[model samples]
Target chain A: MSLDKEKIKHVAKLARISVDEAKVDSLTKDLNSIFKFIEQLNELNTDKVEPLTSILNQSLRSRKDEISDGKIREKILKNSPKKNEEFFVVPKVVE
Target chain B: MSNITNQSLSEILKSIKSKKISSLELTQEYIKNIENAKKLNAFVTTTFDKALENAKKFDNKPNNEQLLSGIPLAVKDLFCTENVKTTAGSNILNNFVPSYESTVTKNLWNNGAFLLGKLNCDEFAMGSSNETSFFGNVINPIGDHLVPGGSSGGSSSALAADLTPATIGTDTGGSIRQPASFTGTVGLKPTYGLCSRWGIVAFASSLDQAGPMTKTVNDCSIMLEAMSGFDDKDSTSINKKKESYSKNLKDNIKGLKIGIPKEYRVDNMPKEIDELWEKGKKILKDLGAQLIDISLPHTKYALPTYYIVAPAEASSNLARYDGVRYGYRSQKGKDLIEMYENTRSEGFGDEVKRRILIGTYVLSSGYYDAYYLKAQKVRQLIKKDFDDSFTKVDAILTPSTPSSAFKIGEKTNDPVSMYLNDIFTVPVNLAGLPALSLPAGLDKQGYPLGLQLIGKALDEQKILNIGYAFEKNCGYKNEIKKWWS
Candidate 1:
């Protein structure tokens, strides 16, 4: 269950976080120790146990699917790091 | 008037109602305390001007009937305060001011409490100690070098230091109670879904709950009553009728059955913590409550389960911070994907990055069943253990933490050691139950130790009542000598 440098890089990639080369070794070590700690869960037999998706036993409540609130486009875009007129401006996605 | 800052929330409320201390005067006193105690590094953003404005407004049109009635509170930075900086103690959100108020903070404001400031916390409410905060470590006011237990470190520190009359904090694991234990304050994590999570910076959605951190258990009850309610915005919020916890609070727990879980005695536990637990039992017994020894057999696996579940959810929740919306953006990236990678890497601190990575790994394709699913099943067993125990006893008692506050930099390098700080407190969160940490005694070094009272789901009143009775009989007073001043 120990993570190596390659696995650490792969996971970091999936998480969309870039790992520095200098930090990879220590990161790998820390992840391995944490994984080692998590491995203790394997000792419990949960074959028939149900995975707890929610603490409350009730079903998710639904609301009427209608336009509730709108016309605050400027407020929605106010916190964007980079935005223009009506939308968030990201780096060029389709070059 | 000089010692006005030293009064509890209830006492201040009484004075304000009697016209003895105006809201403006109270706010000014707290602002002065916060200014003079800046060495503790408890506050990330101080709202002294806005606080003063609100205080003046409240004083001009006083409303004594409201719950808080113009009390100023400094909440943990994890809560999103509208038009104010809500960093969650991370560099990623250093400049991000939320456009909307979180439902919890909104509730607090509606009840007549205004923001004094945003207190520092572990980044994204991720770490057990305040050391993980990007703003910097909040020194426990009890001593110069002790780490304030976190991610509610700032809330606990501010409350203990009298920077705020009372404060609120979110507990994912032990964020509220552990710090409360360390700082010798009262903290209650109400039943999961008791408080709405809308607009809070997402950590682990299921386990993250907002609760009160106050100077006394009575204050905890009053604050919790104000802070919790059904919200249409949060799907998980309980829609049950709000109970008057403060009004119904009774210090007489005679004939009530309290459980003492034998499994909480972990190996190498401090001798004083054990003595403190024994003393708590004796106090409860003397108060006419029946104490029974019970077993929550799956208690040992709670931490490991929490590590897997919390991080897995965190990775998914934090994926929202892709540099497209708000928060820190890296200048190094050339393309969209690279921009996200660089932004997350540079924006988040190391501990946050570590949790995100662990979350991403466990929820990844090949490992999902072995780690994430398995942990969820273990989580069910953990919850069931509490359910089984609650059927036999009204509430359970345990030590709030394994030890008192540790010195800063002592366990920073070892993540596992740091995770152990929440051992006693994490189980309550997993079961979606309510628990309160009451400052019962101090360690040999004069560091505060707390005893926890665990209750069934939505049973905050019972635990708070027990805590009230314990507070009356325990004879423990926090002798925090304003060393920072």
Candidate 2:
């Protein structure tokens, strides 16, 4: 049930976050304690239950496959941290 | 102090419509109160200029078409407001001005409600106390040293302090109700899909619900009626017509079956909370309600299951916050992947980062089945418990929170202790049922204690009726003197 620094670091990586080296021990401790607490669910007998995704059991509603929203590119792109005329600027991915 | 702030939502609406009080005057009074109460740290953004302009427009020619016309209300920072900053109480979104409005807030605006400002909350609606907000902790209006329960802490505090007539809050797991309970105000988490979650900041999408935080149950009903309607934008929105809850507020629960879930009795619960439950039961019994002993056996697993399910959903939902898109971007990274990591690490607060990490761990390759899938299955069991119980009882009653408001920074170091504050309230969210917290009585310290009424799916009317009957006798008022300068 104990999470080590390596595991914590791995999770931070997967989550696209960077934890400070000094804080990893404390984060590991917190994660372990939380995992230990949630381990109580292991005691339940949930053999026949189906995973409840949505409470209202409503089927997904579909509409005509036409563009409904993407008309405001200027408004949408205004929030970008780094943007050109029509694209969000990120570091080059291709080598 | 202007008595206008003390009036109920219905009273204010009536006065506005009757021209007894101009919407501009009423709005100005709220603006003054909001301006004067900065010590509470309840508001993250104040739309005073916009509110005044909107009030003038409404006063020129009052519109009966909108229910909230000229009504000054605060929105929790989670809901998106076009051209206004919607931070969701996080530094990542500190400068993020949304282009579109949330459907619920849009519905309110369409019905005549004007915004006082955006209120503070726990970052991404994660924490039990408002301390996790990047804007700083929202102080409880009732007690200077106490915290306004969160992640809708600012909503509750604003209402309690009379800074605004009413406010809107979101509840993923007791975000709305717990804060309402702590502040001695009324907050209802309507049935999931009742209100559109279209533009509200996502935190556990399946569990997040937007509801009203108000001075009275009647106000909560009125506000909810205005805020809820099926939106084609939200995939899960129920296609049913909105119900007129305010018109249907009948104070008669006679012969109605009320269930007292035995599983809610936890060890070391505050004596006042237990007494409040007993008192609540007695009040319902006095109103001729049939109180029955019921059991939700999976109650103990609700918190753990919620921790897994909510964070799992949050982890997925919050993935949109990379450096490339909107919000904060870090300059420390030299490469793309490093940029994403650094941006997220710099943007999100500690509590938010912890949840993201926990979420990532649970949903990781080897642990997905053990954590996420298992939690989903247990979630079904938890829902089944409520489903079976509803067949026998019309509604369930329990203590809203285990105790009244605790002093600020009391449980900041221990996240688990903070999480326990929502023990009695989270099950309803996991099951996607309607629930409300109403002030039941005052504890010995004069702080208010609240009791929750959990209703079956889409059965908000029954819950409101029971709450209405109980409120008549509770005699609780959040008329605490302003301790904050």
Candidate 3:
């Protein structure tokens, strides 16, 4: 259950977070310590248990697809780091 | 008038209603306290002008219908205040102002409560101590160099130091109760879905719940009543009528069965905690409660399972914080992918990044079943253990935290040691039950010790009653000297 630097880097990539190479050594150590502690859960037998995603067992409620919220596009765009009159400004992806 | 901040919430409300003291005057007094208590760092943002304006407006209208009319209270920064900056104590959201109000804050305002300001908390409500806050660690009001237990450290510290008459904080894994324990205030984490999670900064969606941190158990009940209700916006919001928790706080535990979970006795538990537990049992027994020994067999696995599930969900939830939409964006990126990576790297704190990495690893391609799915199943078993125990007992009693508040930087270097602070409180969240921590007594070092009472789902009244009874007999008052000033 130990995590190495490569695994930690892959996880950081999957999570879209960049880890500095200098800190990755310490990060790997921290993650491995936590994993070592968490590995104790493997001893428990949970063969018949259902995965409980939420405490409330109710199913997701469905409704007609309509615009219930979000008419103020200005308000929605207000928090964006970079926004034009109507669109968010991001680095060119397709280019 | 000078000692107005020392009055209880009920007293403040009564004075406001009786016109003996105006809401404007009371709000001004609280503003002064917030200004004087700058050294504690309890408040992240103080809405003094807004609070005074609201106070003036309430003074003119004289609304008897509003329960909290003109009461100035601090809110944990985790909840989105419509125009105020709600950072959740993270640099990633340093300037994000939510367009909409969270249902919980809206409910408080509707009941005539005015904001003292947004309080500090753990970054995204992730850590146990306030050390993880991006602003700075909140110093404990009770002792010098002592850490106020968190992620609701600001909430508890403000309430304990009388910076605000009352405050609100969210608890995922003892975020509310543990700080309340450390500061000797009362914190209640209501049944999951009892309070809508509509506008809260998501931590672990399933585990996160909003509750009250107040000076007394009675105020906790009043605050919980005002802040909770079913909302259409949140799919998980319970649709039941809200209970009259404040009214049901009379001293009554006659014929009720209170379970003392045997599994809570971990090795090397502090002497004072054990003594406090015995004292709690004695008080309940003296008040005609039937004490029974119970077992939640999967208790030991709660913290490990919580780490797995919470971080997994957090990794997914935090993916929404890329560079494009909102929050802090790094300028050192050539492309969108690098933009996101660099932005997140610069924005989030160390603990947050660590959780994200752990979360990513557990949910990554090869390890999902062994970690994520297994934790979910283990979560269910944890829930079943509570369910089985509840069928036999009316409520469960345990120490809120394993020990009293620790000094800052004592356990910061080791994540596992810090995670141990939530040992008693995390299980209640995993089970989606209501639990409250009230100051029981002071330890040998004069730090406050807290005892927790856990109730069945949607059964907040019973635990409120239990907490009220314990609070009355415990004789613990969160009266600290004005050291911060």
Candidate 4:
């Protein structure tokens, strides 16, 4: 149940968060304790149990997958940190 | 004007119709009430100009007949309101004002529901005690220093304090119901997708549903009627056909069969709640309803399953808050990535950081199968328990929370103890069932007690009918207003 600093950094990378070296030990300690509590599930007799996504057992409803969203170019850029008339700009990802 | 307390949204709307009071007058009075009830910390930010302007719109549009035109309601800060700062009870989004309103708010606005102000809540709607909110703790009007049960704590306390006729609160796990139970107001978490989620700040998308938090079942019906609708923007919005939530409020519950789950009678439960269940059963029986003992064997795993699934989804849902796109940006970072990390690290509070860490762990690559997948499977077993029971009964009755509201800071540090608060209500979210908390009676300690009636999917009316019947059956006085005095 001991999550090392490396393990914490590993998880943080996958979660897109950058964990500081100083805080890694603290998050590691907390995550390990939580996992320790969570490990209790192995003792339960869940051999015959079926996992569920919804209580009513209905499939999720979905709309037609088409580009029908109303155009809100101005509204979309209203809160953007950096935006031009046609699109949002960020630090260039590639040359 | 000061005593416009305990009036339902229907009563306020009626006064507007009869010309007994202008919508502007009603809005101003509640605005004054919100100002006076400052001790409750119920409001995060008030949309004063927007509300008055909207009320004036009602005056000009004589043909408009929306149910809540002039009536003011406190929107839980979790929902995005255009031009209003949606703090989400987090400092990370301290200055984050949404450019668009959530579909639920949009629908309400289309029907002429005026906004009062944003209510305070736990950070990112994470805690059940409202204490984690960056805006500060919302005091329960119950006055025992009891936490107004949270995330939606502000909405519940405001309703209890009569600051507004009603408030819109979201229930993810038991955020709405626990607070409603603690404060003795009517709150509901409708079947998933009953209200559109396009604008709501995500907690757990699969389980989060918004419904009315009100003073009576009838007001809930009216509010729900206005709020519940299918929206194209929300992929999961119910599409079978829209149903009026208020239509069946007056339906007779005679011969209605209610299932009481034996699994819920855990060993050494709070005596106050256990006794209240017995008394509630007697009341239902006397109303000519049959109470059948039932078993939902999967009840034991519900809490564990909910913790895993909700946190997993929450982990994914919260990823959007990195300082780059929106929310708080740290000024101290040396680089772009460092800036995002440091901003989130400093902006999010301790409890939120803890949950984010747990959420990350559960959904991590090495542990996803063992933790996240297994939790989803247990989720199915939990649903099956209710499905099997509903075959023989119309709805299931259970306690809202394990006990009454705890004193603030009592279990805030103990994460497990805090998670245990949603033990009873979490199962409904796992099953995606609709559940409502209605006032049953006072606990021995004189704090309010809530009885939960869970209904089948799209069976919101059935729960509403049962709640209405319970309210009718008890000439029970809604006594707790004395605390505010």
lDDT of each: 0.93, 0.91, 0.91, 0.81
**Span of ten consecutive residues with least summed lDDT in model 4 chain B:** B476-485
Interface RMSD, every prediction, one decimal place: 0.8, 0.9, 0.9, 2.6
Name the regions of candidate 3 deviating beyond 4 angstroms.
none
Taking the candidates in order, what DockQ does each have?
A: 0.89, 0.84, 0.87, 0.41
Docking class of 3: high
lDDT of 3 at A72: 89
TM-score of each: 0.99, 0.99, 0.99, 0.93
Query: Where does candidate 2 stray beyond 4 Å?
Result: none
DockQ, model 3, C-alpha based = 0.87
Residue ranges of candidate 4 with Cα displaced over 4 Å: A2-6, A16-33, A45-66, A69-73, A81-95, B62-64, B481-485
How would you encode candidate 4's per-residue C-alpha lDDT over B418-471 as one tens digit per residue? 877887888888888899998888877778889999999889888898889888
Across B333-413, the per-residue lDDT of candidate 2 in tens digits comes to: 879999999999999999999898888889999999888889999989999999999999999999999889999999988
Cα RMSD to the true fold for all candidates: 0.8, 1.0, 0.9, 2.5
Candidate number with the higher DockQ (3 or 4): 3
Clashing pairs in 4: A51-B377, A51-B380, A52-B379, A52-B380, A55-B431, B102-B199, B128-B150
Clashing pairs in 3: none
On a 0 to 100 scale, what is the lDDT of residue B235 in model 1? 91
